[model samples]
Target: MGRSFKIALAQIQPALGDLERNLSLHEKLCEEAIAEGADLLVFPELSLTGYFLKDLVPSVALTPESPALTPLKELSRRIAMTIGFIEEAPGHFFHNAALFLEGGEVRHLHRKVYLPTYGIFDEQRYLAEGDRVRAFETSFGRMAILLCEDMWHPSAAYIAAVDGAEFFLVPSASPGRGTPQKGIFANAKAWELINRAYAQLFTVYIIYANRIGYEDGACFWGGSEVIGPSGECLAKAEYLHDSLLLAVIDSSEIRRARTMNPMLRDEKLDLTLRELQKIQERRS
Candidate 1:
């Protein structure tokens, strides 16, 4: 029998700069997911601190070893979890980071590599960008976590795929934009397309957890979803509401998709690296 993993997306609105309240919300959701027999639970980007923090970033920043995370870390012993927060690294530098906790410990950490500075986003001004994109081992399989704008850069997904990632957990705090038609927001539709494209192209599972509610005048649309390796939507949350979206993922689908498509199998990493090196030399 193949491995079947149950994932729960906690699509909840976080209280701005209120770590205690957000932690309570996460704990509640974790309990709910556990009751539902979920193997993993994922929260949205900056889940512990609502988006559009501006100057409030410092007030809510926390270290990985902060005692505030003890509750979630303990709960992780029962179920794996992906949580987002503002990480206060050494020297007071803050980063938009995600923590993958399992077995009562933080197994992996991913910092947001691409910080959007355009339009309503000013993340770069308050948070430092990460330097790497990595895939880490999990009980279900190797997985990669990308926070918000990191998923917009195709290279990040490609690197994770090359590093043997079978699952991609994207935690986003996307603000709703464009017109609403057919009851679907245009931004939501665009995000769905991006997720499906990456899943199909890499033959991997994509679990996107986006937050909802108003923050600094920006309305976040909750359209969190899970896409299978074959580009199928397994589960999706409702728009503009808090929802716990769950999906059971079949591990064998990745193998079947690769067997049929063979895109990742035939990729030429050496050629791409050499070409990129040449481009870098030209720019220098």
Candidate 2:
């Protein structure tokens, strides 16, 4: 009876380089999520500028005071929100960060720790990746945020789990990175499984919101999914379909899963660190 929260994933199709239009679309989605009684509204990675904006980064880089985000902050009064975008901070470095808004003003901003440089994702070319991982408290419980490729790495979730995060949210523009013949278990499927594996191992709610539509030659899978504490796929949106995926997270599930499995308590961190150090030694 501790707490249970309803969350909504706004799997949107954003137009590249159109700040005003994208912001308006997010505003509408936020209204819908709030109306549906969702405690958290999750948007995709680089949602403000849209994915496939490799060429638009320099031209559309925005300061925090930029007009694009003003309306989103206003929309945050009703429900808590997490929107991803390029953060033009000090120096020429732009961070792929997520903005968490509650009670209207910006509450916290979590930057993407792992930027994908390989394949079609040139995030490393445009963004300076965040270096640390820590959990942040919210109106809902202790929560953590990871963007795109960050979720694929164990550190993002492991550090947060150690830091006492009860829930984790991942914003992504992860698309179908293969031909249609491959099907089913593509990049989207791999991430879904990875998110589920992390959620089950940590006994935390994992919320993944991915984008849809084709940007240039890249095609977003749009199969945003939610994994419960027991590693169950609570809900998954249709692939390539831009829609809202909602999941009800019951915090009690965390206790129940841990009590039943007892894996969290059995973690041997010092030993794990020794093994990791040995691996590093081998690499060096």
Candidate 3:
């Protein structure tokens, strides 16, 4: 027996650029999750404004004090909540940010570091890149957030692990690709592998909430999932449909996994740092 809590992942479709409607949807989902006895609720990336925001990014960008998030902040007093949105920083800069709200306040904010610009993705054209990745303390424990493309880079997960994150929350709007003949969307499989690998490597619970439905011509596959510290899928939502996936995470598993596989304990941080410095110097 260990400290356990249930989390709900809202795998829903957001109307493109419909901020008011999206807020209402989030409110409804939060109420439903609360009724279901969820300790936390997670929404997909750009959930407030939808993905594929090109020039419209500025129109829906929100600051920490934005009135648009008032209701969500209020909801967080009862249960922890996280949602992704376009964050408006100083000087008109915008970022794909995941906001963690708990105890009626904004607890932590993670801006997307790697903005995919290849193929169907073109985030770099509209958003600024986040410079750092770190974990923060929460009521549940130390946690970290990685938005969409950030999870693709191993260094991002590594940074969070080094920062003592016990849980990883990833919000994504990844579009579906590849045929069924290839076995579940190739993109979805990649995400699953990434999530499972990180959970095993860092001995942390991984919660991935992805959006569903079509935006323009691109369809997002909504296979939101919860992976345990042992790299096992605890629960998964339906593909191509809006769903509320729930799972319970046992905090004790993290300790057990870490003890069983002493990778973290045996890591040579100083050597890795020195090597990285040498690489940087060589590049410079």
lDDT of each: 0.94, 0.83, 0.92
Q: Tell me the deviation in Å of residue 265 in model 2.
A: 2.2
TM-score of 3: 0.98
The digit string of per-residue lDDT tens for model 2 on 105-201 reads 8777887888888877788887787878878888788888888787778877888887888788888888686566665536766887798889888
How many collisions per candidate? 0, 0, 0
Question: In candidate 2, residue 248 scores what lDDT?
Answer: 88
Candidate maximizing lDDT? 1
Kindly report which residue pairs in candidate 2 clash with one another.
none
The TM-score that candidate 1 achieves is 0.98
Two-way TM-score contest, 2 vs 3, winner: 3
Give stretches of model 1 more than 4 Å off: 181-183
Give the range where candidate 3 is weakest over 10 consecutive residues by summed lDDT: 178-187
Cα deviation at 254, candidate 1, in Å, is 0.7
**What does candidate 2 score on TM?**
0.92
* Overall local distance difference test of candidate 3: 0.92
Per-candidate TM equals 0.98, 0.92, 0.98
